[model samples]
Target: MKNEPLAYRMRPKTIDEVISQAHLVGPKAIIRRMVDTKRLSSMIFYGPPGIGKTSIAQAIAGSTQYKFRQLNAVTNTKKDMQLVVEEAKMSGQVILLLDEIHRLDKAKQDFLLPHLESGKIVLIGATTSNPYHAINPAIRSRTQIFELYPLEEDDIITALKRALADSENGLAEYNPEVSDEAIHHFAMASYGDVRSALNALELAVLSAEQNDDKRQVTLEDAKVCIQKNTFQHDKDGDQHYDVMSAFQKSIRGSDVDAALHYLARLIEAGDLPTIARRLLVISYEDIGLASPGAAARTLSAIEASERLGFPEARIPLSQAVIELCLSPKSNSAITAIDQALSDIRNGKAGLVPKHLKDGHYQGAKELGNAIGYKYPHNYENSYVEQQYLPDTLKNKQYYEPKLTSKSEQKFAEIYNNLKSNKK
Candidate 1:
């Protein structure tokens, strides 16, 4: 029996079989039109790993019935490019799929540019990085870049079903009995990478102990093969920033479920420092005056996590996450500070009023420091409104407490009473 992996064997043989990327491969799509007319062009495929960049290129070549070749930008040299060009010169045309094109060196790129310009070799550059930021501008300008999104679970499940049933180039000959739980596990845990799903499925079917002369793939086997496929999230990459952004926004939006989901993802990856820093920031920036005690609570939780790190840290971290997510939120503290900062940065600052300046020292009285200062303890409610701000800034109010949260509402009432006392 041929021992090719299912991912390789299940490569889409036709455009119709290419899963996901409906915007590119669906009916009357631009790529579909290009293949149908055999009017191939130099293009770049950009997205996460294993979203079928190579498979789509292959499908396009198969549909067009054109000569196809593939090379890795990391391994292929200028000499290899020359060899492909030599062959294409005889064939009159060829479709070249260059994997990790972001890694294309200057020499290989310079050699390929002319061929791409002359239409002798249709270059399909695939990269996991953003081409605009990673690829040479000249090469990027020469090719139409199509971004392939990660495959959704539904798209991956459909592909898995096809692989399970196909008689040729699939496991139909072995008659594998894959449970629905196994299928769901594979579909969801692949983390939007169909290639990962197929490979794990194939491995589970081939490696499992056979029962009744048929391979049986269980949920445990699927998990063992792909190990939850929790997405290779780079802690310092764009995804990390995105997760942090979502985490904060979820808390602000009061979506406890989403907040907890992001919390678990971060915790699972052992990103405790960011989690620690982000939790404190959210408590102040989001919860703010709405829940004044939340900051202390969040800090207590973080301190607990610090005392016991990692696997145990997540418990206290989760506790803080749930409380913050469910808490009332306010931005008054941030608004007050930002407004004060804006004034200090601009020309709105002034000298402290004489009455508000230090008068405790003996000479301070001689400078008229406490000359007009009112002693509020003698008054009813023990509160008096005098010119606490500088003469120029007497009307400048920085802290405008909102009523969105209970603490802020209490502050509003106190402010109103103070204003009444002033009148």
Candidate 2:
């Protein structure tokens, strides 16, 4: 126990002690309610690393009288699980904290399903991957899924303060003097990872130069202990998708600063592909027709980003993001297309007009294809009125032009004029 890492040693002993994740372990939360009722059910907690998935599992185990067992889905074999089953048989019930439960093989899953159903083994599967996406549906269907968010800076600070004052399973015995700056550095630099913060604090305390028989941990010491600041930006994690969503929404909402902030986050994650793709989508989908020039510029920026690659690529990307955020927003184009698609999907489409059908085929003029097709280019002002849509949708209006920008205003003028001419 003395040799154990500070994070493991200081793991929350009960749900009350668990830091952050108030939504899960708070007094009025569902997990807390279940615990109070002593009617614990199988659950899977999914989130990014160091956000208390295992701590919550351990805390849940500590809150109950059930024999607790920990295993890794990948490292532990079916035989190891059999031993756990045997223990469950003798002990009546067991709270099994299966780490990386997403990786559980079919054999182990099959063996455990009956026990889970019998209430002999209450599973608390912990995984960093989204359970709905990574876990087998068979096991997933049997468990309630909960998401754990990254710890807040204040939460990390609270954990640090607790560790500093704790004599047992903590660094209180060292009598280390940690500055507020150092504490804040540990909290913020860890990026909501409590385990990383605690481990770094422990290292800073133990390795600091002794001052007046006490080790004084400075901000520099904290920085040295935690060599690199790691942000919670897994490209495949929930936070990544959330950031991407916020990025697009911020641009759509015309919040330039917020849009750039999310852009910077994506850039930091080195997700040029996602950033490039999302920006292109925003240009055409949200800003379409409102500022066609901006959409064209966005495409150019994406091309530049792809050619230049990151670091230098961020310049064009930043310009594009700012332009998009400040540009007039309109979803008219996407809305129009989607409305048209919905009509077609719902069987609103009828046979194409004979005049509109392909006349370049070998049928020649006898088939009557394009027999009366009016060529607009040969008419006055390159304008001609003819049946274009299918007969069923001849009067079906899809493109409702919004008077949001100068360009779209012109489009609306031309569209309304054509409608009047058709009448």
Model 1 steric clash pairs = none
Q: Write the per-residue lDDT of candidate 2 for residues 298-330, one digit (tens) a residue.
A: 999999999999899999999999999999988
State, as a TM-score between 0 and 1, how close model 2 is to the true structure: 0.94
- lDDT score, candidate 2: 0.90
The top-ranked prediction according to TM-score is: 2
What's the lDDT for candidate 1? Answer: 0.88
TM-scores of all predicted structures: 0.79, 0.94
**Candidate 2 Cα errors over 4 Å, as ranges:** 361-363
* Number of the top lDDT candidate: 2
- State the lDDT at 83 in candidate 1: 88
